[model samples]
Target: MNRKLWAALFLAGLAAPFLIYPVFVMQLLCFALFACAFNLLIGYTGLLSFGHAAFFGGAAYVTGYLVKNAGLTPELGVIVGTLAAGLMGYIFGILTIRRQGIYFAMITLALAQVIYFIALKAPFTGGEDGLQDVPRGMFLGLVDLGHTYHVAGKPLELNLYYFVFIIFCIGFWIIHRAIHSPFGQILKAIRENEPRAISLGYKVERLKLLAFVISASLAGTAGATKSLVFQLASLTDVSWHTSGEVVLMTLLGGLGTVLGPVVGAFTVVALQAELSAFGSWVTVVIGVTFVVCVLSFRRGFVGEVLEKIRTRPPGQND
Candidate 1:
């Protein structure tokens, strides 16, 4: 209900690896953070840039390259990816801000298409083969990553789990601050009534640009962390479908709700896990779920449910 509660939940998540399969949960957290970052731009700024996969997947490839070839630590590689995504967002934001409505969305989508092609052709990405064998490395040369071991011949390790959890904490804090800050208030105003905010001297376009950059930077953070966890970065990271997956996440969660995306991410990831036996049918199921969410529950699972609890029909409640 409040930021304090959210902080407590995050601390609890840090201890979650002991209670649950850490790697699976860790993947969920990354996607959750990714969805949250994306929501900042679309939910608050009223801008729908469909090319988010470029930031997420692109960063993954970049981080993988840096860690494998450049001999950089995981943290440094993540920062490099974040900065690259931020720069790309800035350049794209500047160019596309001129077009409003669906044109802006289409422009971003087209640009992201170009990025997908570039990734397809890039040699460092190993062409269709992708970059693999990425070391989890160490956390600032302290923790021992060692090698993943198998218990009874089945594999298990908490290293990647902890790594992803730390990054998720960072992402959560960043989004929390953005939502509670004065800047966030301006963004909300722009979302509700951009013309009025602009008339009041808010520099609407500048605010939008800043939002885009922040969103892209956070998406990049998610991507970079994922690259390390999976020990590989491939074309799948930059694919258009990846972008659509996150959009599904934000919509499934409450759009403006801070923690909703996390819940949505967890549910979706878990569903994917359970449905893995179905092979390609998993995508069809997810697509159906997305459509259902769009048509039946416009406020998203959390947002709508909370609306009822937070509001009462004029009758008193105990």
Candidate 2:
């Protein structure tokens, strides 16, 4: 939340491509943004959505289809994809916003299943194989996203990585602004005590609905950017597994904290990449990690750290 931390993160991101694979970093950024979007609804708004993958994967499919088949530019395709996801979120929120707690979560899960079935049958989705070979296309009819750049005497394919990073930063800034705005306060009020917010004359349902739509739109933006990075949109993106993954990222990072999702996303993504060779064992390891984190660090990695810092004795130095 401080300028110093922001500067440090920016510098780390700038130097990451040189230290690690660009594509991997791009994936981390995408998932980080997605988790932040999810956190907006569940962490701040107290809305537990179980079907977030619908927006994320749906947007990926849409952007991939538009870029590959509809001949749309990369940026335009991503924008349309994000908007489509927001529209879907609006409809879903209308249907489920009245429900509370587990019921709301279940309804969202059901809706996501419906969307999943639609994707399975839709011709554009290519059934199980999903939309493949999605072209990254040129950025704004200029800057070829598929191009590579040389840095430090080594060739780094950073064009797409930088593009995704810029998009992530924009999305992060928007989310940060929203979280600190008056509207965000109302959402938090609704989250803390909906009846009180309603008693105070807040349109609780409307606020929740708006928060839901914004969260979905941002998630969709992440998915769309991911599709460009990988040149593919698959069922894996929309599967229930992905929905769970996003939840895990948010929980691991610390819900309600701005940078929690980023930390969680990086950790989960890095673990998966590192354990790729282990195949099914990777899931076991992640499961164990999740259980440990939940039991030992309930506030999440970043959340717990921040809490310690805030609750530390005055004049005590780390």
Candidate 3:
């Protein structure tokens, strides 16, 4: 059943760009991957991080700088960005892994704020203007990512779109593999009962730190790809509000469920895009939608559907 669903999703993704604006679809893919990375921590490891934008936005700046100023290839830029985010995560994990609950969340948020300020003041980042005009660069020294092709009578950046798609798939696959591995089970055990996990001789701190780094790196991958997609990296990418947005995406999609984040990301992105004409009023609509979802579907959209399936009467095909 899961395989079928994954196959269907892959088909849909392949066809989506032809039907929708390629850039908008690419943006959605990036955010979906971002939300999925966040879920790995909060949903699987039971760690609530309130500053994921540090990894997401920080990696964007790194990738943007490298691809634009240093003239690194797109692939290399993303790799370096991912590694940088992982290193940051390792340092952050060392400092905050000992704390739990709100303390942990607050510590993460504070650290993220520091990154935000640094980006704001750093001359290379263009300050409030952001790192703009970030060239997409060559892909493997073969295809020009900046070049566009006419597809089905529409201008489509097929090269860049495919590049982003490949990155998204790789990142998504890593998260899926992590969630299903023995390490992931231990994470689940830790999430269920940390005391019991420790009693079982599990090095809980090490495991949590590992999880944090993995999540941060994947989030960084999403951000790096996003920078290439939009050709810009700004304060908005690293802001606290972006962090909150990911939280909402994870919750609205069904927290621990594997497909929840993607679904939630789609809904939120679609709403924002469609409601853009409303200007600042868009936030009000999103807030109202979130409240309605919370009230009507406590388990989240996908979570509620899964619950129904689980509780259905045996042999009832209908």
Candidate 4:
């Protein structure tokens, strides 16, 4: 990633609300962060988790519950939610980290199903209707998140959007640092060859567990922020379908690329919003788009572009 590009993105984020719906952009940022966190495990660590919705939706429920019922501030609620997700990730990792390939994926899926059932039946979760009317609350005992700025005759929740943007940036930076750090390298090594990593005397299981915890916590961050944005926490956040959606975002954007998830999330989210008029047909359109992207850019949109640059002939100009 280039510094110029980073700066450009920062500028774009700042201008996004004025140009587009703030709530919609906030939703995109949240999902993008979630996909990035998911990629950390599956794309970089070679760990395929089928139950990430447990962390994402679980955090949403936690944040919504605390903010609405417990009277916690938004930031505090998000922190608690993130911590809860990390704890869940730790427990799940302990149970499934030893398994390989589909075994690991299936175990995660099974565990996630338990979480979904709990969400469905739990009294505090509001069952099927979900935890509604979750207040945004004040930020740090000041800066009311519900405050809307009237800009050019359009109402924009600038405060909340910036809050979400900052959160997204923090989460993205953490992931970027982790991916470039020695720990990230080890995870990649494990991803490439666990046997070799084990032979090298690395505590592979522990490392993987740590990565899982990190991923889950960040996913929680996304969920928490999303709950604040929507003022609700619902079953959709915890469903298996949501988990699959993140997977598609990661793959469609480019599994291992840093910006791929963001691109993929934006594409998927924008498509869903644009195709909403078609109702159920939206899924069909998205499915077709995914197939086309997969077939045309097998490495993913970012992955393929990067590959082309890497494999380009020397001295060739764009």
Candidate 5:
């Protein structure tokens, strides 16, 4: 949260395109945003949702359909997609709020499965093929997102990457602000002891529902942006595997800490990209890594490191 750290991260993002593929970086940003959204729920509110892919993939489909079929602008499509996911989250939260623990998780999983089936059967989703060739329309019907600009005599796809980066920054800021707000403090209290939160006269269910909606909406924003980046919306986005992946990213990064999800997402995505040729073995390796991290560093890679630094004895070497 230091200004210097923020400046350093911004500089790194600005320079990343020159060192790595812009598309890959964009993908990492989208997933990072997604994982952050997931963290807002489970990390802060103690809500373990197992069907978040519903919101993520559902928004992708909605935004893709809007861009490809409705001829909407990319920004507008993303907005509608995000709102749709929020509404879905609201309804799902209403249904699941009365439940607790595993029951709550099961209800979410069940709801997401229902959505997955609908996507599979719906004509607009293209079934197994998904919605393809999604156009990255102009930003606000003015700036062409597809257009590239020359940076140092080399054509750089800075347009869309910058757009995605801006969206990511906004989303990240919103989450950070929320985590520091009084509402977020209440959420933490709820997480630590729901009975105590209730005894304190907080409308625990309402706060949780709001948190759920916000989480889903932001997650949808990530998915919508990702659809634009990939120019496709498919079943892969909606699958249960994706739900598990987000959970893994949150856990690997550090559950309650800001920036943990971002680091986790980058780590997981980079591993997948690097080991893609290994096919299913990549999953095995990731699984092993997750287990090792859990066993040795339960606070997660970043979380554990930060905890150690904070708890270290005075004058001890870091």
Candidate 6:
């Protein structure tokens, strides 16, 4: 929980590509950041958003288009996508803040569906074909991200792993700053007791709006990066299923813990990959995982385990 421990963990991430498959690790990092950003609203602000795919899939399309046909760099594309998501969040938040719980979720889901339809019809997005062959391009006009590495000093293709890794670090740092800031404390207080916080002169609605926009922006960042990673963006990115996937990630990882979503993302993504050969069994497995986690791992995989260690007797380590 100390600064050093967190720093060490980040260092571990930075060094992960050396020991593990870079592409897989990068995917994990991106989803982890997505889950963390989603957690900011649901876990800390106590607002469960059911339409997050709007931000995630929308940004992916935007960035995919920009990178593929517009000749924009990856960084610029990500920024544009994040801004788009923030704008959508602002509009949606303004319309939905008055309603809480199921109403708010419904509003978001409906609005997201609207965006999904737009993506479906948008010419730039390529509709069902998707924006394909997206260039990861050069990083800062120096590092040619279109190339990769090798075990015996050879230039391999698919440098996207490193590109995604860098983006993931930036996203993680931004969320860390937000959650550990003074504003974050007020959001937490609102989560604990909204009426009391409002009575204490805090604008609960505004806080929630800010959190929502922040979450959307960060989710957009992840989505945009993902598009460039896989060299494509399609309807699958913005579908309701993706929204559910992120929710499952946050739930399995431990909502309030920064590292929980990372673990959750890796677990879910890996499971999906490994079970792809099983067809319908994949859905059944994912559903079963969600049910088990909800019924059993209430505090999440990391949250309960970490809490237990913290409460352990002297000289115990976890």
TM-score of each: 0.93, 0.97, 0.97, 0.98, 0.96, 0.93
Q: Score each candidate by Cα lDDT.
A: 0.85, 0.93, 0.94, 0.95, 0.94, 0.85
Per-residue lDDT of model 4, residues 125-214, tens digit only: 999899999999999999899999898788999999999999999999999999999999999999999999999999999999999999
Each model's Cα RMSD? 2.5, 2.0, 1.9, 1.9, 2.1, 2.8
User: lDDT score, residue 35, model 5?
Assistant: 98
Off by over 4 Å in 6: 153-159, 313-318
- What root-mean-square deviation over C-alphas does model 5 reach? 2.1
What is the overall TM-score of model 5 with all chains considered together? 0.96
Q: Deviation in angstroms for 65 in model 1?
A: 0.3
Report the C-alpha displacement of residue 297, candidate 1, in angstroms.
1.8
Q: Residue-wise lDDT of candidate 3 within 121-218, one digit each (tens)?
A: 98789999999999999988888999989976899998898899889899999999999999999999999999999999999999999999999999
- Give every collision pair in model 2: none
Q: Residues 1-318, candidate 1, lDDT per residue (tens digit)?
A: 566876788688876766667677768887998999999988888888888999998899889899888888888888999999998899889989877879988898888888889898976778787789977787677765545656555565666677677788888889889988999999999999988998999898899999999999999999999888788888888888888788788889878888778777877888899999999999999889888988998988889988898786677776
Model 5 agreement with the true structure over 1-318: per-residue lDDT tens digits: 689999999999888888788899999999999999999999999999999999999999999999999899998998999999999999999999878999999999999999899999987799999999999999999988888877777777888998999999999999999999999999999999999999989999999999999999999999999999999999999989999999999999999999999999999999999999999999999999999999999998889988987987798666
- Judge candidate 5 against the unseen true structure and give its global Cα lDDT, from 0 to 1: 0.94
| Candidate 3 error regions (>4 Å) | 315-318
Per-residue lDDT over 100-209 for candidate 6, one digit per residue giving the tens place of the 0 to 100 score: 88998888889889988988897677888877888888766676777766756634443566567668888888888888999989988998999999999998898899
- Estimate candidate 4's alpha-carbon lDDT, on a 0 to 1 scale: 0.95
Q: Give the Å error, residue 313, model 6.
A: 5.0
- Angstrom error at residue 5, model 1: 3.5
Q: In candidate 4, which residue ranges exceed 4 Å CA deviation?
A: 313-318
Tens-place lDDT per residue, model 2, 1-318, is 589989999989888899998998999999999999999998999988999999999999999999999889899998998999999999999999999999998999999988888889987799999998998889898989888888878777777778888999999999999999999988889889999999999888888999999999999999999999999999888888899899999999999999999999999999999999999999999999999999999999999999999888798666
The list of candidate 2 runs beyond 4 A from truth reads 152-154, 315-318
